[model samples]
Target: MNKKPNVAIVGATGMVGHAFLKVLEERNFPVKDIRLLASGRSKGKKIKFCGNDFKVEELVKGSFKDIDIALFSAGAAISKEFAPLAVKAGAVVVDNSSAFRMDPGVPLVVPEVNPKAIQRHKGIIANPNCSTIQMVVVLKPLHDAARIKRIVVSSYQSASGWGKEAVDQLWAETEQIIKSRIQHPGSSIKVDGVKKVLPAQIAFNVIPQIDVFLPNRYTKEEMKMVNETRKIMEDDSIKITATCVRVGVFISHAEAVNIETEKKLTPEEATEILRHSAGVEVIDDISKEKYPLPIDAAGKDASFVGRIRADESVENGLNLWIVSDNLRKGAALNAVQIAELLIK
Candidate 1:
């Protein structure tokens, strides 16, 4: 820890992986060396770091031999198989997958929320789901103040959340729609493209299902919110219900959240609390039609919150809208912050 640590970015060719590199460069994270590892298809690919090019290596047993910290954004199965080997190779792993999150031993973390949980990691630190990360960052300060009892959240997740292929699918589908509109002139028409994402196409519409469905009818993505929230909050009794939807946007992930607290909150008071919280930016101003939008938060690290008000339907209920760059704070940036905490 005396000198800057040598780091490895697992899945370095993926979208989240690319963001990790960007954040590391933007924040000027001290790295004596960097190893960008990906699958065989991406091997030998070059990515720029600090204006210098580095060749991507295929991940293997010895990949982490000299690495001190590993940031894992590969999918869960990859993380499940490779994370331990990296840890055994003497590197601390911060995983951005659902692999080790509920493992009782691994720390489920949002640096802004339960940073104290970092000390509990058994080699792998789990970054909560992207949607969960943004929601909890905004909730922790409020929950600390009012004690959240139950949370109901519906996410408008971007195509990027499903990975690069989904983003490409969205672009391809959108182009087809534009072409169809031009050909049809004033007549209404529907265009369909090769179905590369979701069950169907993802153009000019929203897909309510995200990830795969479970026997209980809720998606695995939805369950991640419930389980991850409880673990990150360190309160098993906290109730959470989530509906994860895939949207056509290609960057930020947005959510509509309603919470039941132990105590009542006024809109003015809630705004005051969030205004003073770290890593939170309030953008509510109906008079000027100003509010948090996906594009506004596409490249930002902070969570943008707006539309704060008390729910009239239930006592002690508060409603909020939250958005953030999923690839940043949701995955890469959060992992980088955890690494910073560890090295400190």
Candidate 2:
């Protein structure tokens, strides 16, 4: 790796792609040069970074030439096609897609959880799902203190997790609902439009499904959390289940995570452990009603944990509320941290 690497960002016009640039600049990553590449439609678009305007070029086989680190967020299909090309071009890819995450050859990494996995990458590293990234960061310290046996998590994900279009849909539907309420009082509020991104109306509603349902009746997003958590923790024996939901918020994801550990840990003990852990912020204070909220966690890199309590149903059960910005720590920051490790 170069002391000052030349980087390329695939999907430069997308939501997580924009986040990649923001986090790279905020952390002052050493970069000799940068190339912004996207789909053909986004070609010639101008994106400002580090006080300079760069034109977005259409991604192709030649895009990875002379690039040291390539951060990919274009999606699984694009990654499956171009990631190998990037690696063949001598640019190590840190992909933010599911294309190679479950591959035995790829290391699915969250810097705060399994940073050592970065060293084992064979020219390509995989970033876990956004939901999985935040949950695992909070789970690692607790799992180390008392080995986790089983996990049950329910995610309240924001529209931003889908993409920029989903966010626009949320606001558009919100405005329509508000106008209907104001004009036709005592009538049902309805949103009128052909829904494009989300499965159902997301305005003032929550959908329990994220990705397509599998034969096992679990959505793909839910299964990703279950599998990715075990892989990152390196403990296949740890039983995991998840219910992913899409909420009306525009940014940040919140999860209600319940875990059963082999050994008991009190709320105070767990709080102390997480407070000292890297990439975790303890925000629990029930008396004054202070806890992790999606609004408060937006644009932040740390995984916020709160609502610490003991589940009385099980012998060694603990509950937590975890929150983080889906685009930052969940996707861009995690990939950037892996690149940082590569440079180190």
Among all candidates shown, the one with the greatest TM-score = 2
Tens-place lDDT digits, model 1, residues 1-344:
42599999999999999999999999999999999999999999999999999999999888998899999988999999999999998999999999998999899999989999999777899998899999999998898998999999999999998889888888877887787555444442343544475765666667889989999999999999999999898889899999999888999999999999998878888899999998899999989989999998999999999999889999899999999999999999999999999888
Segments in model 2 whose C-alpha atoms lie over 4 Å from true places = 182-195
**In candidate 1, how many clashes are counted?**
0
Report the poorest 10 consecutive residues by lDDT, candidate 1. 182-191
Q: Measured by TM-score, how close is model 2 to the native structure?
A: 0.97
The true-structure Cα RMSD of candidate 2 reads: 2.0
**Whole-model lDDT values for every prediction:** 0.90, 0.94
lDDT of 2 at 311: 99
TM, every model = 0.96, 0.97
Candidate 2 colliding pairs = none
lDDT of 2 by residue, 85-155 (tens): 99999999999999999999899999898889888889999999999999999999999999999999999
Deviation in Å, model 1, residue 115 alpha carbon: 0.3
